[model samples]
Target: MSAKPWPEGTGCRILQEVDSTNAEAQRLAPTLSGPEWILAHRQTTGRGRRGRPWANPVGNFTATLVMQPGETPDKVALRSFVASLALFDAFVAATGRVALFALKWPNDVLLNGGKVAGILLESAGAGGTLSHFCIGIGVNLVAAPSRSDVDESAITPVDLQSETGARVTPEEFLDLLAPAFADWEAQFSTYGFAPIRQAWLNRAAKIGEVITARTGKESVVGTFETIDDTGALVLKTASGRRVISAAEVFF
Candidate 1:
């Protein structure tokens, strides 16, 4: 178990089951005074980005961190990077293997080049501010979905136990992740996204390597470049530099 203590002013609640942690965050946002971590051992209706169904096998880790971030939507969205760094730290702490992990662009963590975790961000508000923001995280702790479960071009899913022989529970993983997140969040709140962007870049996957970014409209193939200050994926394409705000990256 991680010796890391929980963050101050943060609330944590564990549920035996839920529809989805993100959904629960939405329901609890109105009543929450500070940040809260909602963890669910089982999710009946878990979903991912673009409303894709999330496969949550037994013994995996699933949770969401909800907060009433008073920043602009763009700023709030960048918290995905913060969450990524936290996951990286927690995974290393759990497995004692720092070199095996990498952070994928936007929001995914790779273990030995295979996907081991994913992050989904959801928020609601108007007038250029957010009422609440939730960062939903799902980690393959003990078991992963079959190869046929994901997209044809997607990276294969991997489990921590299968890969590293680490048997961390959902609650234990949360214990490590919550404090790590709070630390990165503190940096973000104090110094802004510059340091976070640099730190994330240092741990990013496929840097300077050829990759493909597919959006709803088209696919752009280019060398993986640095993420811009606004958290857009910057790629050096054949024609010119392309700054993609959103896309499905394949490497």
Candidate 2:
């Protein structure tokens, strides 16, 4: 009857305040298109997986790209690496150097010894039915939240390479990420996800090393195997192969 209040297409919308990009994405659901909307500047309500409160600060790069409809929900796990790649490109482009970015399983981006970027995807619709996915990304650009506030260790681009005498601004970072999604989205649709899976593993940290994994109820130490073709992180368990859809990994 009336126009639904949502952003149109091809550009990312910046917001100064919101509960969370993922949450806002939920609100925009039931009527979403691939306009690639983002609400990041400050999130009064931020979230990590499994109800963990993410420390989302202002003046950083945080966004939620609303994916197109009709894709199966479970398959969206494959999209996580695409988001990771987008952030990785932004990291390298900003710093103008190689090896400046790395992945920490499922979806955390690490720079130096601390965190610089995080990727979150939320679904809106029935499990087996057609659905839209919101890919939320947070990249620290300027200031850092209090170290004491971080549940686990975290770092930012500024914390690592600020000595370069030229800092990457939020605008510049977002500019890089927008075109990145455009490029990666094409690859994801045409070739499925094998290429991205390989690329992610190549840049993945501790792929062959044993690491600690926390999945809310239990914490297990296991050797990190490569990500399977299905996009689930494979851990070589003592019993056999254990595929993880979501977990907080640490070294």
Candidate 3:
């Protein structure tokens, strides 16, 4: 059970099955009066960054938080960090082990040095004005895909049950996650991204360590310095400090 209550006026819906929660979010965006969480018991067509297939495998966690954030695209996008911090807190709340988890830059949560959860952001707009934004998250709670399921350069996937023996259902985990996210969202709303960036850095994986960030055919290898105020990944290369807005990070 979450120590904090769900944020007032937030809505939650659980479906026995769906093609994708993000898709559902897009469809529900126009009708939502406030932020809403959509969770699916099973996703027949789950997806990851770059439209890669995401393995569902039943009993895992798959959901999306949809809301109308009336902000610039860049500002709206920083919620990925907000979501990352919330996931960290929810994980700690579930297992009572803070030392076991670390957050990967950009949008991944690491458990025991392996990828345990991932975040994907999507938005709708016209003429550069925003309409709605969705943060889709997936967690390996009871099962993980085979090594062959992921790209060769990707980190191995780990599940909560396998790694920590914590048995958390999708619904129960959402109960923990939604409130944690609300708290961080409140912090972000109040103090801006300064506190969120610092908080994310404190729990960041590979901070101050050598890492590789790949963008298509190009790759930069450098020491993980920090995430800039704008949420860009800052790497200290021999050439200089490089700020990357998007890329796949590997340790």
Candidate 4:
């Protein structure tokens, strides 16, 4: 991997195969002196939100960024939005198309209204302060799983190659992504989540439409309002505005 595009104090390792980049990042976090990245060409045991199996076939982008954010859990959680914006920018730069891509609430990248990428965040800390965080990202580059391979209610998967008719290798995607992420991270560090939130709102998937937010126990159906100050999804129900920190959103 080329080191020129990466941020200062960032270290990276590329592996041909791994059980999961996040797991590897966890093992390295305690010993890391600075920000580090772990990239896997193939992940045998990758996972998504709620421990769902993540398919990391060869040629897809599978990587984990491990860093010590040194912030409160609420602030650290905002990285998901930051990462999503970076991913959106990177995909647009790689494909040179801005119309087909949108960012789902919280942290999923949609291509032509289909799920093309997902973000998973894991952290270890105590007393509301984060010691380290692992931001695991997976993007479908060459191929996407069939509808039968995923949950029936989940959005159909889409791949970059199929949508753009241009071959995009994982390496090339990461090269574009690394610099984009650094740019957003710098913005987040300087201006806080307000700027990031506004940027996210601009590319949000269904801002004014009614959507369903399933939070495991119950479901809330309401108009998709803006995200709140703390990065919660604000939904306008008949009763009032409801904020959700985590849930499965369906449009």
Candidate 5:
């Protein structure tokens, strides 16, 4: 098979293995001239939110894009929505089935209600502005960990190969992903979060369903309303609508 192609002017480094794409991105960010992508065939110490272990089998997709957003860290954080939408677009394009996938709140991509991918955004610099940000994404392309392999309480994992009954390599997946991400990132730059927010709600998983959001300290149960203007999750409870900026969601 031929090598996968990336978008024009985008720099990429593909590794046989790495500690973590995000960590490598952070280490290389200082010398990168522009937006660059770091991809690894396998990760020895991958991680997810809250420092949970992220399983990175050889055939799955493990990559990170390092860039300077030129905005406050809080503003750049909204790129999570952008990244989620990009993954949705890429998945649909790759599988040619829009009905099989959904975007979960915060940063997860689900297939038939089972997670197929996860997104993690980490940044450097203090105060308000961010010097650089690493958007790490892990997609289960050829293999997925069993529930037993990860924390038992975590959501069951899904793989693209099993769902579509076709073989897809990590490189093929990234070819579709890179351009989709660029498109969404451009839209976000020109139109702000309004369009991304609307697109996300359109593909959102379990909106309007009764669900629970678990903040580290407490859990809030309510009907999933919609995401507000600022991207906070809006949940309707007996009292009123509560906007949550960060939490683990369960439906």
Candidate 6:
């Protein structure tokens, strides 16, 4: 129902009967910059990292952003926290309470003990002069897919059941998300990950508790030590300190 292109630095939105927002964003990243450069009405094949499919039914916010700066991939790892902070703030605005928002590592937003949103970042080109990159975001606003469509237990904005039991709109969510995302992106761009790390830990689900992590061929339970300068999830192991590159964790 939004009539005009949202007047923001990153508000390059278009309507499609259905197209994967991630793909659309990647296809457009070489051009647009900032906040939300691409968004899809319905995603036929929205994907997450590791070949997971991101649910993109109507009404949920399925968007992607183009991130470009003078940093290497390793240096810009803080983007995860920045993106999470944006969704966290959006959750607070939606429910008028911050207690329901929590982070599940790198970039997953949990609500009421269920996944409400996730972020997927990918690169293009190489080196510091990268062509462009895309950060795909999927939020379960109107409906949550069945277990078969999601890797984790399902959740829906309908859980809020807004008096009419109708779904939440993408517009309503984007209205709150854009400003919050811009704010956090500004912080991450200005400062570094140190401050964001503390903010992230404040809402992190498994900060001081034992969590299960599945890296590749092994799975272990350990206390999450901390996120180092480069954004690696450090786990204190019995043998020694182990910093993991990628893993599926549960608390």
Candidate 1 Cα outliers beyond 4 Å, as residue runs: none
Model 2 bad stretches (over 4 Å): 1-9, 30-32, 152-166, 237-240
Residues 1-251, model 5: lDDT tens digits: 22234667778889998999999999999898788888899899999998889998878999999997798877799999999998998888787789999999999999988899999999999777788999999999888998888756567899988888757787777888888888888899999989999999999999889988998888999999999877889999988888999999987
lDDT of each prediction vs. the true structure?
A: 0.95, 0.71, 0.94, 0.90, 0.88, 0.71
Candidate 2 per-residue lDDT, tens place, 167-189, comes to: 66666677777776667767888
What value of lDDT does candidate 1 attain over all alpha carbons?
Answer: 0.95
Output the TM-score of candidate 4: 0.96
TM-score of each: 0.99, 0.85, 0.98, 0.96, 0.96, 0.86
RMSD of each: 0.7, 5.6, 0.9, 1.8, 1.9, 3.7
Q: 3 or 4: which has the higher lDDT? A: 3
Report the number of the highest-TM-score candidate: 1
Q: Ranking under TM-score, best-scoring first?
A: 1, 3, 4, 5, 6, 2
Give the best candidate by lDDT.
Answer: 1
Give the better candidate number (2 or 3) by lDDT.
Answer: 3
lDDT rank, highest first? 1, 3, 4, 5, 2, 6
Evaluation by lDDT, superior candidate among 1 and 3: 1
In candidate 1 the C-alpha lDDT for residue 195 amounts to 99
Model 3 compared with the native: what TM-score? 0.98
Candidate 4: tens digits of C-alpha lDDT, residues 1-251: 22236677788899999999999999989999988878899999999998999987789999999999878887888999999999998888887789999999879999999999999999998888888999999999988999999988888999988988868787777777888889999999999999999999999999999999999988999999899999889999988989998899998
The model with the greater TM-score, 4 or 5, is 4
lDDT tens readout by residue for model 6, 22-83: 67766766666454556677788778879876667667788777766567777665687888
Better of 1 and 5 by TM-score: 1
TM-score of 2: 0.85
Candidate 4 colliding pairs: none
